[model samples]
Target: MSGDIQPDSHANGHLNGSSERPAPLTVAGVAQRLGVAASTLRTWDRRYGLGPSAHVAGSHRKYSPDDVARLERMRELTLQGVAPADAARAAVAFDPAHPEASPAPSQLVRERAPVERLLVDPLSLAAAAVEPDPRRVKRMVEQEVEDRGVVRAWTGVAGPALEMLAQREKTDLPGVEPESVLRAAFLTAVRDAAVRDDAAHRRADLVLLCADESQRLQAHVVGGGLAEVGVQARVLRAEVVQDPSQVLDVVDRRRAGVLAVFGAVPGAEDLVTAASERGDVAIFLVGDAAPSLWLPHVHRVRTLSAAVEEMAAAISTHV
Candidate 1:
């Protein structure tokens, strides 16, 4: 009976008569198997220490079977709403040889005891700047967005994080390069929140555009925030509309109820003037730019939150 080879009915692959193991998996292979982005795996490795254990000389690091299993547990826990830090701790301690010996997901959840903490507070930015962890910053922003809505997440977390990064950039501190990563994370979170509605339901009630080609990020933030409140807004990136005249065509073609011009770039006054001349669509001017004349159709808002509130009000009136 000991020598007899019984084919495993449950296992995908049969082991040889001898107790041999498969080769270590590459990062790509592990990412594919776990259904996570390769970059995500690297981030977990770099930030959480959930990386490959086997490293050969002059060759890429390879993930052992146990390493992959631990990461898989981490991914599972995170998807189940576990905090990244707690999940990473659990994963690192998990024994792959005896999975049953590891703490159950529910036990892990109970042990961690979920607390509804405001991950991003205005005052917290100061501490975040003092001890910056880019991974933690990205995760907190994303988690806040999921827990709170896009507006709260932006105002409370992402916006402050970006402002801090910008401030740091202005200083003479070297090796502080968090702008690109933080921006990418914030954009991805906002965009994902924006596109949750069905395509047919995304009809344009308001068209959000940058004043010129330089305020695209502001345009997107406004658009995403508007989208969160069920206000369908067509966001025109700066690259798409080079001239103010091009905006007229978009407003005409879309029959947009409102036109929101963000920031005061070059030719913003002309754009506002042209839109006002139409006298058909309500125009919202955002930022510090003062209107040349107080036109009945044009309204100026000081902040993105105010812009969203104005757009929502406009939509309610039209509906």
Candidate 2:
């Protein structure tokens, strides 16, 4: 093999910004570097005998940097449909995963699920509900309802988890996004709960302001549910201006006393803080913006139904 050096190159590196090659890596370090659970590496060893090595002195099980490099090469071949055993042999025989050394995506995947695996854990039945098809997601939600009680289905299975998955579904992770459909499903669960006469009968004049069209769309699905609960809303899509004068202006001009959807702009807290100055209006937020981030000022709601519930709570005195 031509002696070349680069970081994470299964082969000698000429591409990565390195001059001299570094020494081989250890098994534990490889597992960390590859971002996988160590158990997976142990399994790969038993199944494929990959990166086999003995102890340095105490006969401790270990893998060398070169072994990690070889395994990485094998991962690439396997990704391209080659058998893992064949790939392992090819890598050791000077066929590596990279032309110049760099941490390959395949190596990362081989070690563990991607960094965003929590969002797509198949066992996380709740996470699977983010599909665009409302019917499919609702069906699952109904199933959850049957399995668990109404409140448990919402707070335990569907609450904070949906909030997190919504963030990741937009990320670059490759997986099925079943959020909207799931949201629809969970909404069905909450709405199915026996509607009690809301103690307070206050009218909620709600206004939704979002940064752009896409954010606006997310807000509407939420806003539509509120309308069902008798909280009338006028949805407005606006560019994320630095000042809240425009937001306040719309709220004032439209005579909307409640602002529940404020997520289009990332700096929603600032807007909520600004709205707080208006004191007469009640502000609520749903999304990554922490409820504790700006308490009392803005009620934090993760899902559409929660937003509606928040709206109901705020005007409880009148409702």
Candidate 3:
């Protein structure tokens, strides 16, 4: 709104020789414009000084056209495999008068080397998840599954990316939105990859449950992987059931031969004990912090394939 530094109106939609100044954009608006998460914009602003120049003291920051252009340049550079810090420097030095004068080819190559690993790597998946770009994340995740199968895709792509997000949550922002977005995309992809056994006489042989909602993806991936090998695994959510004992009831009703639990569920020993007592059932404790339960037929597994293979073997033996 200041007379000394009005951004180009054309950049913000004013055109056809119009002289009107464009409306200022809030952080959310700019985030929407750039197809990135609001958290990402805040991170850039805090670390790279790419915040709105129109920001006034004691007022909510709003991006001017020039600010948006700089961010656009920053995004472009980063997407081209340029490191964020390097891209920020280039973005800050962007000359609005010559917007086409982007970072030189030589500069791009020099800056891109360090970040090239992001292209089709777990780093890229994590970055996409942080950005919370559902469509892109969904495609990339499913592609990993299609190319590497459920087990590899979960271990090499989705799992690592999710773990990265979880770690970042502890060190960075205190919100679950980014993780939730990635999980949604991951579950969609894994669920779609499932090769369900639809035969009327084919009953589910295994019942899968996560320790909590956070481990839902692991359970789903295991279920999907089991389905691929012609094993029927029923995925049950402990959170969805009113009581933990109800999970056991479902298992009994389904006549599930294998009970595989992912992650460390608090006070799950009772359920594990009950399941273990079912002489006909095989119990599996999965993940790094698998519960140390004093029960029989308890198989501890740490990897997706191990869990699937063990459950499949149990089912085959039971049959």
Candidate 4:
């Protein structure tokens, strides 16, 4: 490798096997460094075939700087709605003068006030849960919602980022209970995003107010993903009254296109019953719902990946 360094650059910036101090970047490393879910890398590897031949440690995965750069480029492409496989190919062939490319990361951040303050700043949400860092989480949620919309912020940013914190804290890592703060921040973002100008050509999007305990958090995530693509999502995270008849009023008042509940939560039967009464709007009871209680209008998403995929497809189909 060349020992020369560019102006204002360190030789240390070069990523490869040349350094003895720093270990080679693994799939997990890149995932963490890039602030994306590990599952996203697996999707790129399996679906787009964007990785090494195999890891030196058999099942382990390693990525060179080129690989990480390609992944970031691919993210820019796919988030713009290009398919993963196509994005992978495009990343390999990106040009400095590429006309189709929108703003660079710097410009995108500078131009969008929200994305700059929340979405781009990596530790904004993480800081919020630490009490000492309340604004961090709130800012992150606000940025994501403002940039991608409420549902998108809820799912893509707040949900996963909170889960990451919970996992970190659960394993006896540093930090306090971030769940409440994160939820509050997400709710704030959702409310603020709801009144934005809607496109005249956009279809009538539904707001799903999740009111079941088990479904509340999952529903919030779903709501966020929905918001990313311009769908409306409201989350009433718990307070689904036992009176199924009265529940109809909440759904109707919100003009909900879909009523979603967390099937894993207790009193899920009541949730299903409430949805059963709503004949017109689609009812989606997420999480593990009993097959016996299944209704035709109800849609169940088993995992985060499944939910993201479903939301993307549904948005494309409808909105």
Model 2 Cα shift for residue 168 (angstroms): 11
lDDT of each: 0.68, 0.53, 0.70, 0.55
Candidate 1 has its poorest 10 consecutive residues by lDDT at 7-16
* Worst 10 contiguous positions by lDDT, candidate 3: 109-118
The best candidate in terms of lDDT: 3
The residue-level lDDT of candidate 2 at 281 comes to 75
- Residue range 1-319, candidate 1, lDDT tens digits: 8888875432212354646655778778888988987657755764467888876654445888678878978988899998787798889888876666887655554354665554467446434544556566666666776655566677777677667656653553477556655666677877776776313235445555555544556667777767655567777756544577887888778778888776655666777788888788788887776345467689988887888878767765552
Instruction: Please identify model 4 stretches exceeding 4 Å from their true place.
Output: 1-128, 144-157, 167-178, 197-205, 251-255, 270-274, 277-279, 289-292, 303-319
TM-scores of the models, in the order given:
0.55, 0.35, 0.56, 0.47
lDDT of 3 at 235: 73
Best-to-worst lDDT order: 3, 1, 4, 2
Cα lDDT tens digits for candidate 4, 34-129: 688765665465435555332455333367555665677777777898645566767655432333563333333222233343444334566557
Better of 1 and 2 by lDDT: 1
Which parts of model 1 are misplaced by more than 4 Å?
1-118, 122-135, 169-176, 198-201, 212-215, 239-242, 290-292
**Candidate 4 lDDT score relative to the true structure:** 0.55
How well does candidate 3 match the true structure in TM-score terms? Answer: 0.56
lDDT of 1 at 183: 65
- Models, CA RMSD each: 16.1, 20.2, 20.0, 15.1
lDDT of 3 at 243: 55
